[model samples]
Every structure is written in C-alpha cells, then in structure tokens.
Target chain A: MNEAITTISVAAGDSVETLFRAHYARLVRALAVVAGSQEAAADAVQEAFVKAHLHWRRIQRYDDPVGWIRRVAINKLRDDHRRGGRKERAVERLKADARPDQIEWSNGQDVTALLAELPRQQRLAMALFYVEGLPIVEVAAAMKLSEGAVKFHLHQGRDRLRGVVAISQEQLP
Target chain B: MSEFDDDRMERLLGAAGGAFPDVNTAYAQVQGRVRHIKQRRSMIAGTAACAVLVVGGAFALGSTGQRSNLQPGDHGSLSVDASVDTQSTPATDDTSAIRPSTTTAGSGAGSNGQGTSSQPTGPSSSTAATTTPSNPATADVQTYTCAGGTITVRLAAGALELVSSQPAAGFALDTSTATATRIEFRWRSSSDDQSIRIDLIGGVPVRKV
Candidate 1:
C-alpha cells in the first residue's frame, strides 16, 4: 500500500512537470504575439503556471489542463491591459526595442505590427489559431468564447489583414 | 487574397513568434515563483493565526478581568442589601451590637462600588477616545514641510488627499505601491523634484520625506 501510494504521488508530480515543460515555451511565444511584449507574455504565462502548480491536485483532474492554464494566462493579460500602466509600459518597451532585424519576417513583412492593428479579440484569435496552431474548439475554450465566436473573430481578422496587405501592395512603387 | 491563404497566414504568424525560449529555465522560474507564492501564503496564514490568537487571548483576558471586577460590585450590592435588612430589624440588645457592623459593611460596600465603577469607566473612556481618531471622518489633518512648501494630508475613506501650499508640478501619487499602511508620492517643485512617503502609523498618517 505504501509503495502504491508513493508511486501515485510521484506520477502526479511528474505529469504536471511534463505538462509545464511541453507547453510553457509555445504558450509564451503565442501570447507574446498577442501581448506585443515577450516579457509581459512570459510573465503572464509563468504566473498562470504558478497558479496551476498551486492547484494541481484539482486541475490535473480536468480534461485539458493546458486549456485551463491558457485561459488563466489570457485572463491575466486582459487584466494587465485593463489596469493600463503595466501593459502600456510593456508596449512602450516593445516599441523602443523593435528593430528591422529583430522583428523581420521571412516574407519581408512586419507581422507583429500587422497583428497589432487588429482588435484585441481578433488578434488573440488569430495568434492562437495560426501561431499556436490550436483548433477553433481549443481556441474557444482558451478564450472562454463559443466556437462560432472564435470562427467569426478569425474570419474578421483575416479579412482585416488581407485589406492591409492589399493597401500596402497598391502603394508600392 | 489568394496569396493570403491559411498556409501563408500560418507561416507569417510562425515567423513572427521569433525564437522559442528555453523550457528548462522557464520551468525553473515557475518553480521559484511557486515557492515564493507558497511562502507568502504561508506567512500570511501564520500572521493571521497569530493575530487571531492575540485578539482572542486579549478578549479572553478582558472578559476575565471584567467578571473579576464585577464580582466585587455584585458582592458590594449584596452587602448593602444585607445591611438594609439588618437596620430594619427591631432594636434589641443583639441588634444594637450588630448596628455598628452593618454600618461598616454599608460603607465598605459603597467604596467597592465607587472603585470598581471608576476602574471600568477609565479604560472604557480611553478606549473610546483611542478608536475615535481611527475613524476617517474624525481624523485630524497632518502637515509636513517640503522643499518649497508644506503638504497637508488627510485620510478619507479608502483615499488620501494632499494639499500643497506652493504650486507644485507633476504631482503624482504612486498608487501601484500603495498599501494599507504606506503610500508614496512624487512631485516637482521650483526648488527641485521631491518625493514623500506617507505611513499610516497607529491610524495616523505620518509623512516621511
């Protein structure tokens, strides 16, 4: 009985640690695109993981624990934005640090700047769908929105980016 | 539009993500943060338990003192009643001898009531006075001299008000670091830029330059 109990405890610990190792980097990168600052996104993701660790006993029972962490991180980002000061400071740092070489796209376009032009919800949906490669259902779960709402936001975001690209093409000499 | 298809969108977003961070380092940081959070929570819980124990102990002591003090008054009142009963009895030889005893008992009872009543009232009145200043509506304004002028501070309900004698520019309160007991402020004056900290010590705001 003692050996079995020890094994179960070790398994639980390993599983949560495994989840953290698997998803931390991808979540941070995807959130950085939405948050406009790698630092802020990393902070939010770390805070979410900390909370997940504290509540792992209950959270591990969930069908998708990563979904819970994503939701928490996104909510933290939203709260930071609503608070205004920290998010503004992060965006300022992003603006100051952004260089042609630093954020240059392979296609020779500033995709980060383009995404920044999209509304917050659309930007989040687009980043999760494309950058993170999450399905609409998972994106909806993370965003706490319906699948239809996620789809609509994705469609609108695509159209907006397309229009921006076309306008830039028209202006080219 | 055709060029901006799903594949292109994916590639653009993927490229924009730059480089993936080191998972091991991030995991280490997360573990550190978790440990910090747990430490803070435990400290808070410990402090709260200590506070409860202190308050509970004080309350228990206060009640015990009150009961002990009231016992004398109760016995005094009973003795006074007994004295009255003795005085009302017929003036026989035995009653005459008990008259002096009854009078002494009555006077002792009067003094006990006076002493106990005075003892409880003194602390009660002081307690009331001490708590009155803690109420924001009744709080007094505190002033401190700065480089150029004096800043008067008033504590309101969940807010702090500052009034400067001289015109100061860039007066800003750093609410981000505001706590129940301390708040920081910064402002620019003709002399130079100044910063001040206000600490709520014993329910009174004290200015620290």
Candidate 2:
C-alpha cells in the first residue's frame, strides 16, 4: 500500500487515475466482506473514487489519498446501512443468490460468511486490518473511530472467531 | 482451533475480498457520473440567469414606457395640480389660450391656496395621477359649466366621484360611462342643453364636444 502511495507521489500528474487503478480492486474486495455483497461494495468504492476525482487537487496533497478513498467508501457504506431499506434488500438478494464457487484462502472455509456473523464495527475493523492489511491506526482513521476502539473491536472479533472455531471442532469430534 | 490464529484470519479475510468483477467499466461509469453532475449544475445556473434577465428586461421596458407618456407640463408639482383642478374649464374658440391661464394659476398660487387645493377630497382619494398608467386615479376636483348648472367630477380609486352640482335638477351623471380615464355629464333644460365628456388620456384631460 505504501509502495502504491509512493508511486502516486512520484507521478503527481495522473495521481487520481493511478491510485484508482492500483487500489480499486483491493478496496472493492475488502468492502465486499464488510458489505456482504460484491455489487454494493463495488458501487460504494466507485462513488468514493468519483469523489476523489472531483477533489483530487486537495486530495493528492494528502499523506495517504487511498486512506481518504477508503474512508469515503466506508462512510458511503455506513450511510447506506443507516438508510435500512436498501441495505436490507441488498442483504436479502445476497442471501438468495449465495454463490458456492467462492475462492477460499483457508481450506474452503467461507470467510465472508464467518466475518458476516461479527458485529458491523468488528466486521469493518477486521476487514480493514486483516483483509486490507492496514495498521490499527489506518483502520481507525478509515472507520472514523479512535485507535483504542479499533483495538477493542479487533480483540472482540478475534475472540468471537476463536469461539466459532472451538465450537466447530467440538461438533466434528 | 489452535491453528486458527491472526495469520489465518488475515489470509481468510484477504481471500474473502476477491478480485473485482470489472474495473474498466466501473472507471468509465464514474467518469460519466462526474460529467452528468457538471451538466446538471450548468443547466441550473443557466436557468437562473435567464430568469433574472427576463425580470430585469420587463422592468426596464415598463420604466421606458412611463417616461415616454409623461407630458412636458407634467414636470412641476404646481402645473400638474393646476391641470387636474382646472381640467373641466370650457374650451374657448381659441383653445391655445387655455394653456397660459393654466400655467399662470399654477405659478401664482404660491404656497397658500395651491397646497390645500392639491389634496384629494373624495372618499377614495389615496391614489393620484402620475406618468405611470398603472395607477390611473386623479383625486383632484374638476368643475365643468354647462347651460343649466356647474358639475364637479373627481377621479379617485379608479372611479369617478361627483363632488357637487349647483342645481342637480337638469344635470344627469351617466354612472355607466364613469371610469378612471373618462366621465360624461349631461345637462338639459327648457332653454339650453349640453353634454360634457371629460377623458383623462395619459393623466391630461381632453374635452370632447
């Protein structure tokens, strides 16, 4: 991520486009886990990128423009969730059309479903810190929460996952 | 369960965020949305500008029309008041002689009689004559002498007010013909008969036989 930001800093002329091309895919994927729908996540990231494009002159001067984009995307998602109707409809559609051929990283475990079980804040913190490989501070900034809050969410999420794993193991035996 | 640690969680979460379905199409869509927003803002700004221009143009045209209709004698307050008061004076054989008398009375009255004479006396006398045709009221008394008696008419609140009549027996005011712009008073007796038609055209009275 720092490499991508450095590349953007070096090529200031087309920084917004460069940043979009570099980070758009990763951000969409991470937000998909947080949003629980690929389409909704993609839309949020696209809106964020559009905003970044409009305000690039000010955004390009920031320490991390991608962080700004991430924050905007997260905020968009949060706003959509607060609207209730759209988020519920999107969740219902996602559940109805649950795809079985998702590429797994841990022996075919459904990581998206596992993360969905966590609370909204914990889910976002986990996705940003682990999936997006961001530090606790960046996660806090993107989530617009304090670093201590992000840490607590991360801790709570980890404990929840551990309990799920323990329960699965016990069921298998 | 021991193997399910932070590294495992990172790997699982990272993998759950699969590759984007379509990047090129999305970038194009974002650019399109930005252009659309710009077009909408420009349209709103253009509409507001046109509305302002239309209102300003109407006001300017109205002002120009009012100025063009104003008579040369309508400039001074004294002359305007005198013209309203003495509009009912009978037209002499030489009509040009009436202009000097009207100006002389207006200038000679000074501060005593003219001040009290300028005020309107009718029940509805708030409005006064001006160059603007929008307000057509002229709340000054006008006296016309006919063969039978003298009739007084005053324009107030877009209607003709009959202030007084000396004998009221022979003179008959046609109420249907009375308006802010025109009035007709007819007097008939055994010896004399006459009709006085006073029309206020552009705040100046024109007597028709």
Candidate 3:
C-alpha cells in the first residue's frame, strides 16, 4: 500500500520510520479489536511491524502487506491470550480502561464493556470479522478455528452484546 | 438492518488494533546481538590457536633438556655402582617363592572362626596373593602410588584427558558449556587420587573425543 514498504524491501537503504508512522495507528487499532488490552494491542502490532520490516525483502512482492501484518497481529493476540493463563486479568484491564464517557470503542459507546464480558473465542472472532474487516474464512484461519466455530462464536458474541447494550440503553434517562 | 444483526456487529467491530512499534530499534537490536555472537566465536578460535602454540613450544623445550641430561655414562654408571655394592651379598628368595608356603600353613591351621582367624591372617593373606602368576590375556588395572595418592588406570579403546579441573572434591567434569559435551560421576574423592576406581563402563573414556 505505501511506497515506504517498497523502499524498505530493497536494502538497508530504506527508512523504517516512514512505514511505522503510516500504518502504526491502523495496525494497533485492528489488533486491539482482537486483543482485549490496549497495552497488549500496542505491543503486538509493534512487534508485527518490526517482523514485517525485517522480512520486507520477501513480503514486498505479496499482494497485501497490511493483510500479512493483520495475520501476524492476530497470531500474536492468540499467543498472548494463551500465555495469560486466564481471561480474568484481561477482562479486568479492559473494564478499568472503559470508563463509558472517556475511552472510545470501535462499535459504539460502552461496546468495550460488553466485549470484555464475552468469552475469549467469541470476542476474537467478532473483532476479526468486523473491526479488522477480514473475510470469514481468513478470520477462521487467523484464529486457528474452524469456520463453523468462528460463526458460532460471532453469533453468540453479537447476541450477548446486543442484550447487554439494549438493557443499558433502556435503563438510561 | 435489524437492531442486532450483522451490520450492527460489523459496526461494533470497528478500529481496535493499535499502531505498530518503532521498526528501526527492533531491527538494530537483533543485528547487534548477532554480530556480537560472531565476534565472540572468532576471538575464541584465536585464543585456542595461541594456546596450542604455547603448549607445543613448552613440550619441545622440556624434551630437549631431558635429552641433554642423559649422557652415555649417566644411567650406565648408576647401574654399575648399584651392582658392585650388591655383588658380595647372598641372593634373596623372590617374594613369589615364599608366598605359597605361608598360604598353606595358614589354611592348615584354621577351618572356622571368621574373626579369630582373620586377625592373624592379614599379612599372610597378602603374601598368598603374590604367588599366582598374573594372567596377561585378560584386562588388568595397573595401580600407581603417587605423592598425592593412589591411582588405578585400565587401558581400553579410547583417548582421555583431564581437560580442566577446578581442584575441588566435588567439581563436575565438563567440557566447554558452549559445546554440547558433558560428563557426570557419582563418587567423590576426599584427597587427591585417594583410592578411586575409574570404572570404564563399556570401555568409554571420561573425556570428549
């Protein structure tokens, strides 16, 4: 997508700062949807970009560098989730950051609060499909999940969020 | 669109992944570490070559000095002097001849009494051992008594060397940690070479080839 990617692909002649500035925020946001924590999303996206830059010589010829990075960030999210042992800490962290009036969510207001309550698989599938804009097949592969399972988690995740958000909206003045 | 359909979910899934890291710093860190490892390897190779030269030179000088010290008259004169002093004395019986006489006498007197017979049988028992001619057909360990202690070495199929030692009673025998060579032993010696049996299990040397 960016000319800097081609420049970095050739040799030490390229400046990586240009690529970092261009895609850094988008990559982080895409990863944050998959990864629950802001700090973890930042770290995972940064690591993905760093890996991409090192392999840019080969990756430049590919049709989509952004897709490669999204895949990397998704894998990193899954790896981090597994290493965290349990989702309680990640959920608590998300809850702490989501003050309802302050932090913004991708979907809408208080969406982070509803997402934090979802099972990890559901949240991941929903995030990849909607936030990252990946096709269902790609999302399944990225998540190391079957297509049926991904769809099931997505269905369940959306229903739960709808129930929570609607209940909150009805109670509002 | 329905209130909670695919469109609603898709809208909810919006921009969440964050920006990527500073790519330059990460690349530089990896490159530096790799370069450092390569430099360390080359330095180690140079040091090894220098060590070989120093050891070779020392051995050559020591051998030359030993050759110089051994003049024609030196060893011959010492043997000649020893023979002259022993010429008048009566020849003593070899220990082999006297061993069997003591064994036969000890066995004839005692048939029982383990502790009672063992008391007087100590010296006589050792004397009995020298009578049998040593069989060279089978493997036998040669024992050497040095100033530090006694050492028993059995010759087998491979080369062995004490590459490095920390001079401790329980120091582990190891090659270099960088290399995947290691050795472990169960026994500990309180003093140098103090009554140790270097059991060559399956005839393997206690060193890396």
lDDT of 3 by residue, B63-99 (tens): 5344322222122222322332332111121121111
DockQ of each candidate, alpha-carbon based: 0.23, 0.27, 0.19
Record all residue pairs in model 2 with backbone atoms less than 3 Å apart, i.e. clashing.
none
Docking class for candidate 1: acceptable
The residue-level lDDT of candidate 3 at B3 comes to 26
Q: In model 1, how large is the Cα lDDT of residue B198?
A: 63
On a 0 to 1 DockQ scale, where is model 3? 0.19
**CA error at residue B136 for candidate 1, angstroms:** 50
Query: After superposing candidate 1, which stretches have Cα over 4 Å from the reference?
Result: A1-14, A89-104, A107-109, A167-173, B1-5, B71-209
lDDT of 1 by residue, B1-209 (tens): 21223876777776656578888988899899989989999999999999999999999666534422322112222233333333232111111111111112122222322212221123233233323555532233333333322233445543444322222333332222244566554556444555545676555454443
Better of 1 and 3 by DockQ: 1
Per-model TM-score on C-alpha atoms: 0.56, 0.55, 0.41
Q: Name the TM-score of candidate 2.
A: 0.55
Pairs clashing in candidate 1?
A: none
Chain A TM-score for predicted structure 3: 0.67
Clashes of each: 0, 0, 14
Candidate 3: segments with Cα more than 4 A from true spot: A1-24, A58-68, A85-90, A96-110, B1-7, B15-209
Q: Which regions of candidate 2 deviate over 4 angstroms?
A: A1-11, A92-109, A169-173, B1-5, B58-209
